[model samples]
Target: MAKQGYHHGNLRQALVEAALGLIEAQGPQGFTLSEAAKSAGVTPAAVYRHFAGRDDLIAECALQGFRIFGDLMNHAWNDGRPSALLAFEATGRAYLAFARRFPGHYMAMFESGLSPSVTPDLAAAAARAQGVLTRAAAALCDHLPEGRRPPASMISAHVWAMSHGVVELFARGAPGARGPYPPEDLLEAGIGIYLRGLGLIPADTAPDPSAGTAPDTAPADPAA
Candidate 1:
């Protein structure tokens, strides 16, 4: 997206961009509306013409983020083409890609502490994004015995938690930043371990995660 800052009729978008930049650089509550207005090259008072306040601006950012996230996850899922397991893995990779590609939006959507119910649109966007993962989880786990199968939502939540942990704990840090063992390898290995535990992947058939312990994953600032 081009940064159309403070254009004739796009002040709303400009302020949103400013808020996203601030969120990425200084966390959600670290900056003020006045600062955001300054960054967007507008008067602080001009912000109210499009948004009620900073939270409103942040909500817009979250809204946009969910839209983009949904698209990425959906694309990665790709109707579970080739193989459900492979597609699911791609979706996991896309999570890291999204956080790297849109740190501002990622922070706003997940780290901002904004209520999921802040707005109907925000809520709907969030649900749609979440639904993609659930669908993928369901597709991948469909072969499980009915009594043994975990709920798709539960599987999706587990994968989401693991992916989020990798990003927060390893991907963003110093020594872990594409180090001797990249976060990507950690995530894939972890996922493999998880699926093996679930019997979705048999140990003998699963890739020897030990072999790919090297940091050979593709370069991405996340999706770079």
Candidate 2:
């Protein structure tokens, strides 16, 4: 039977938000199309009005996630402001912050098993989010020796992987989610180590990327 009393200003977006909540609670494959419809306070058949199937709905959610992610990355990079080092580090902090604030969107974008290339627009959005980091990496590499600078793509990928690992292993849900170190510290120090190896920052000093700001007060993690 169809749900009867629900109304919304934007039914499609209503469904997407409802589905995102379900995904956060139950993982992507854990919920059914009927569940999403019910969560949206509509009939199962109503889902087909905005989506071909469950996969299509999840794809839309991922698409929206990528757009938001791209925006966050762009803002964090801030066109390489303060300094390239700080801006680049801000982007890294932004990665953990996004995962912390938007678990459903994060999972939808990464762990949903839906290939971003399922749609051209989705692919573009995913690429745009990643491109911001790549651009930052390229700028930072300008500090290194021209003869031995690794590809910016490789540098960005390494950082992305590290950030994602920290989020998965430490940053999300409850105190001490993983190891002893906070995700921010772990990632900052890790990036520092990586860059020091590349001869970017001074090798002897501590790896303090956002030296102007206190450790907890750095401007990368946006409010949830």
**Model 2 ranges off by over 4 Å:** 1-9, 206-224
Each candidate's lDDT (Cα)?
A: 0.85, 0.85
The TM-score measured for candidate 2 stands at 0.87
Q: What is the lDDT of residue 15 in candidate 1?
A: 88
Residue 38 miss distance in model 2 (angstroms): 0.4
Give residue 21's lDDT in candidate 1 (0 to 100): 90
lDDT of 1: 0.85
Residue by residue across 130-182, what tens digits does model 2's lDDT show? 99999988888785678877899999999999999888888879535678988
Rate residue 66 of model 2 by lDDT.
Answer: 94
Q: Which ten residues in a row have the lowest lDDT in candidate 2?
A: 215-224
